[model samples]
Target: MTTSKAFIQPLDRVAIALMLLISLLIGLIIWQGDAVKPRVRTFTWENQQIGSEDVSFTLTFSRPMDTKSVEDNLKIEPPLAGKISWAGRRMVYTLLTPAPYGTNYKVQLQGAKDKFASQESSNRLVQPFTGAFRTRDRAIIYIGVNPEEKGRLILYNLTQEQKKVLTPKDLVVMDFEPFPNGEKILFSARTTNDQDLLSAQLYTVTTGIASQADQEPESPGRVDLVLDNKTYQNLKFDLSPDGETIVIQRGNKSNPGDFGLWVMPTSTESGEKPTAKPLKSQPGGDFMITPDSKAVAVAQGAGAAILPIEGDATKPLDFLPQFGLVQAFSKDGSQAAMVKFNTDYTRDLFLVTNQGTQKPLLKTTGSILNCQFDPSSPTLYCLLTQLVSKEQYIEQPYVVAIDLKTAQQKPLLVLPIAQRNVHMNLSPDGLGLLFDQVVAQEVNAPLSGNTLKTDDGEAIATSDLWLMPLLPIADTTTADIKPEKLPLNGFDPYWLP
Candidate 1:
């Protein structure tokens, strides 16, 4: 009986060992099935609101993430303790309670673990970001007028606290130019009693006091700056970089033809009057003074030239296959930009160097209404318009940046709707843009058509000013940086330093 019992015990022991081995194999398979494969990629958090009680930002992954795994693994801390919600596969976290305004806030995203087995998990990670900004105290002003009065000018404060109106009291403000220091503005006011007679005047505004320098009690402004009525009709003018001289186009009213280029001293004694002397005269012309204030670029008739401000003769810079207009000169007078008018009357932008070199800055795609150079960068900001499918002229305006070095052009902002009589004015620091925006409704055309019309055809005029902050290109990825619009309007906007 003892021998039989001992044999049964040994068999029992062998059976138990086999069962234990099977259980161990099953446990190994279960552990392998639950293992996770991990990966790490850099992500940017955006839309972080500054000066808010609570700050929130959205984390965008390079690729779609596992919603369940992300929700379970991710963690965010007042300044950032908040619940996270799924935003179309992206993770968005927000504070449950509002945080104090103007207080600094930080956000950290810990590493996430996946549910895939047979992959090793990554180390825990954390990324820190800040949210903070000061309250804004600025306003935007928008202005609009009849198409004939396109030369409106505007002036506002840096903080947007104060504003002044400098448009000619009774006459139409034509060809307005701001001084280099931005304290004074020069504009031509035309009095059309019987015929078109124009007088160019300079208005100086300092410490909130507005007065006409040429019309001062002690000193009368120059009335003969252009002198010839026929010449002044088709003439355009610009101020030198130093604001010490004015470059104008001059001709006789009897002739009513393209006169020539003339430079006149902008400043003089109460009794002393400066004379404007012709620099270059040719038909079908335009000219721009270089920012350096040393030279003037001229495009007359079928030829283009560059001449010294005080020179008697001008040198031919470059000859174009087709005639074009010299729109602007670079700051150092090293480059000149031109606009080519096509058969359809659309314009394209090009650059011409001091050595007579020409290069295309913007291609002719749509009708370009206006183009201005950024004072700080080598880019041109232009207003573009195109025809819509409905046969209506839809003016789609954009702020574009043209990289002179690479000849690359990029659109920075797009207007929501068509704006008419639109104008763009950039700040001296390149931080803001003042533009005219017009919203046109199909109200009945007034009998006069000079003002806005109501639905019943009664004329009614309405326009607004828009202020847009020029965002730094480097910070384009940040969604929280929104352009602030100022609330004011006047023609020709000049920003005070």
Candidate 2:
């Protein structure tokens, strides 16, 4: 037994040789100083499609890197302007602005050297890295106005020049808001047999776009009913920025006075249907979900109250008494554009901030139809009407860019006068503005499934979608910019996030 234990097999000799080789390599590495090329240990956004919410990408190296060398040698195709920062072996590239939609981008770093690379004898350099990323395609969703596709939600891929009808012709889509991912749209529609405008029900329809690059895109026009209008009439609705919560204004059918804002999760547990829970707060008007998605800003009484959608709804998180309406909030949620109804029958738009700053932005004699904050810049784009004639009370709708920092207002375009149904949506990249110029139908027919109406609820004969490219506020004037009319005929056109 002792002789058998002393015998070493050929396999054991091979293992011992491998161990000696590895030890020798390790000893050489330590004795001669590390000569191995630095490599990227991790990359946060490799081969990913990012959106507005993605502000930065990170790179972690196997060893500490020269910050200035890495920043100077790094290159991004399509030339994204960004600021580089470092923390030991990690590097972060913060985008100066959201990358434009419908574009593919590449990042390269071949010449960047690690901090300890200079002392090595062999070619002291970092391993060449080539990473790729992309932004979501440029797309828009609108209610189709064509004879064959009337009253249906249509998703038009501007980048691919592809169009898909998202809702069927049997139901007339009243209003819709795209999910943050653009994979689905939340909309309200009424059945073909039901003509009452207030009888619309909430539904979700697939957009034929996959939420992830690896997932296969499903066919569009698959509709799922979310909430029925049998007990309550669902009015205006808003989807939170995170796409996790939905706030809808509802009014009880039996009790005319029973009305308030309702909150619900966009998803539910497995085998559980989504349900809406009434928010225990005062009745609100023109409600919207805050940027955080945890609270709802509702126009209650004479103030805009920020009420938690979840626990303790009765206690408001905040209240701004000066603002009668919240037009829009900045993506950062630090500021908001609010409206105040003046005693002299005027509307004043103010820039209200979370830092207890209420700065006046604009004053209008007519209505402040809508306003959106530019996600990339210190600007607020608004669609408003001006009282051109007192006798006729003629109001002309126009688009204007207001610089939040300098308080400079630039009139972009003056739309057709008295087009109250006109709607405007700012592009996610802050490079374009979309607005619909609608032609109202003279016939006052009863509401039907085939009948189309503007977002204002007025019957419309035809509508044209227009896209206007925006310039930096300081670079040029409105005279140089032009509004390009799209080939689609639809109202309430909105950019798919």
Candidate 3:
């Protein structure tokens, strides 16, 4: 030993110390590797609420998990119960029986052990969930029809089980008007139809079945037929809000040239035919009655004219120039919507007041087929279609709505191109829209033998009645109340109010 000590230097001793320190670090790493505890970074769930069907869960480890160990140690309760099948790494548990409508469930995962014998603690999770929904009731539809038999009005309430028919036989129902109260209906009928052409036969509906005498004759149905003459052509008629008077367009059907405006009482006594008085002239087109029932808006010649029910007899309303075809009036009677055309036959919508001031409501690159005011709101809905080229006669239809106050135009609905001859009508509440959509189907014929011959067969024409809510115009997602084929092919749908 003494001989070696004489040769050993200080540098040799330092090198030996460094080698021992490195060896100690290597041994510590090997011993600590499997013994280190794993920290759970976070707990996640597939869903806080689970259904009664199948539920699955997954656990993420800070390090790569031993798939074999997890599959062997994982357990679920109320137990998989033969209803669950594992999907590789994930453990799935399904209930053998469906849980109640609202039931709370618990999931327990047993701590899994590692190859080094390190154990993971157990975790518990509770999930509350609900079951599926049940079915709903069927919708009901009310149908109104004026039978071909004179003085007969039939109202049928069609439901899933039975149909209820309401016939006021004692009262000759002329036209059915939905009462403001909605419980009962208001109708004008021929209480007495005097055979005489111009007899003052009193026509009235039972406010209460003839209980009193004076109430019957106070407001008789004596409507005047303005275009009674052979040359007069009937256009369209609108009833006043009070249902006392009607404004109609009288024109020459044969000539298709002459036109005039007429005001009638809308009711006549038994055997008494109400007389029509001329309101205005000059090739009358469309007419609308103001809600206040004090004025009538008539589309004549080049513009719309408002005639006061109680004004100067000599002069007609000052024409609101550039506004043609006054189609509708706002609910407040403060605005009138009309359409005008140019030399190229492009139609545009314009709004005007009874004072003869006019402004553009909608400016379209294409023609506007028809437009109407929402009876319940200030919005104006229009049906617009592109002008069909000479080469093609059929064109697609689109519905657009314009806020009268904001002057914003937006598309409401775009019907399929296959639907032609489209017409739209707004409901009384302005919350629903009714439209007639015409669809055509091609018919094919089977030729002799196995060969098939395709030829243009009879085109099936059908007019369907469609209804949609006015709200959520942008979504265009609506539940069709009832899409029914017309009992008999008909169009020009109008709601009675």
Candidate 4:
């Protein structure tokens, strides 16, 4: 009995020792794995709001990396349109062009080693890292509805089929411009107070939620104040394509004649910067922002002047005195559209080059209401109106597309005279034109916060927005085209860049 007990006790002790030794070995392995591996300090928004224009990306690591190990091991799934650079423990990838929207991207690093680890095992990977990010869906924003949704900005994601109301309660938003980066919106808003329309002030709202190392998880859409010109009245404002600058039109509190274009940064990043400073431009007139944001075409006096946003604003470009309004500028900033008004109220549309040379494109007894340039082609979409009935002075308005190179003009849509508060827009892809036709039986009173002409200078009966395909026309004539109806009621519809 004594011999049996001793043998059993020793065997049990041996088994316990083996178990303890196995546990100790496992702990050592885990500790070594953590100690030798490098870490990444991810930028919360690194891949969240990637747009086609986001050319640069930055990645930071906890330790200095072996340049060759990372450069050779890093792989972007499906490939991307960009180049890469290294900086100590950081990596930067600059895109040659914008990444296509609505895509999922995966980044994998199979054989990456830190500098210290390279000394021990030159080809060994410290750890395998994998991350996935997605490009934003195609989205559109428009002001819609009344009573409950009045004066609010609505964001509709086309890919996700989602809708989000961006603005908070009760501030009547008049006019808003989205930044090129799609990260913010520069808007003019006025209180419920029935002040003069000129009293509208510019404010910036954060439409994006950037990832931060220190911030709590929060939803985007934060409204922030930009500039409130208490003395001068602010009007039309345009945000530059790069999202760096803003050009605004302001009028004096008492003298409407004392009006000019102003320039300021479109950022509230440091809080409301400065009330925009007046540019060297002529008195108030209809104007358009050049793509470069360096110049603007102001329809002043009897001519259209291409005035620099900075520098000698007084010394305007000596354009043809007969050209009255500058309509549209090409996306590449190479060409422009200018109008020449005749003594008999006849309107002539001319295509102007960047070198200030002008060529007449269309001549008609009609007025050019609005125009937009096609981003991908040499086409100009212009709204034309002519007095058809001399007795009633009834005018008919139509949308026409003109091929600048061919000097061919094709009528796209014949709008009804009852269509009021109409504006034309070309989709970003250049595949479609989006516009809205509003008609009212009774006189349509202009919405207080509305900036663009809300009241139909004449009367329009039923208001609905539409989308028309821009391509697939075998006939250069208007009959070959058919517009699809979009089930929405909005005046100004703009596609995101």
Write one digit per residue (lDDT tens) for candidate 1, span 139-182: 22222254543323343444545654444324444455655533
Off by over 4 Å in 3: 1-235, 251-259, 267-273, 309-314, 353-359, 375-377, 388-390, 418-420, 439-461, 472-490
The number of clashing residue pairs in each candidate reads 30, 0, 21, 7
Candidate 4: worst 10 consecutive residues by lDDT? 209-218
For residues 1-497, write the lDDT of model 4, one tens digit per residue. Answer: 35544345788999999999999999998866636467556533344656544566676777788877777877777687567797777888776545555668887776677777746654545466677666656666776554455556766666777777777756667778787756667788776554455567777776553322233434657887777877788878877777777888887888877878888865567675555788965684887777887777778888877788778988975555778888888777888888888888788899988786778889877678888886545778888887787777677888888888877888889988735356777765456787877654455555443222353334223456787877623345546768988766555666666
Model 4, runs deviating above 4 Å? 1-136, 209-218, 268-272, 355-357, 444-462, 472-481
Task: Give the top-scoring candidate (TM-score).
Answer: 2
> Each model's C-alpha lDDT?
0.52, 0.87, 0.49, 0.70
Model 4: clashing residue pairs?
52-98, 280-313, 418-460, 439-460, 439-461, 440-460, 440-461
Rank by lDDT (best first): 2, 4, 1, 3
Candidate 3, residues 1-497: lDDT per residue as tens digits?
A: 35534676899999999999999988998866544443222333322333222223344444433455555554533333324344433334344332221223344434443333434332321122222221111111222222332233322221123332343333333234433212233333333332211121223232121211222322222232222434554345566776667665665557555556677775576646666776644555666677788777666667767676555523555566577777777766777778887767667788877676767877654657777786545678888875455466556678888888777787767777635456677654455566765444344533211111111222323344565556633334433332444343323344322
TM-score of each: 0.56, 0.94, 0.48, 0.69
| Clashing residue pairs for model 2 | none
lDDT of 1 at 302: 57
TM-score of 3: 0.48
Give the worst 10-residue stretch by lDDT in candidate 3: 447-456
Question: Whose TM-score is higher: candidate 1's or candidate 2's?
Answer: 2
Candidate 1 is scored at a TM of 0.56
Q: Show model 2 residue runs off by greater than 4 Å.
A: 1-23, 120-123, 443-449
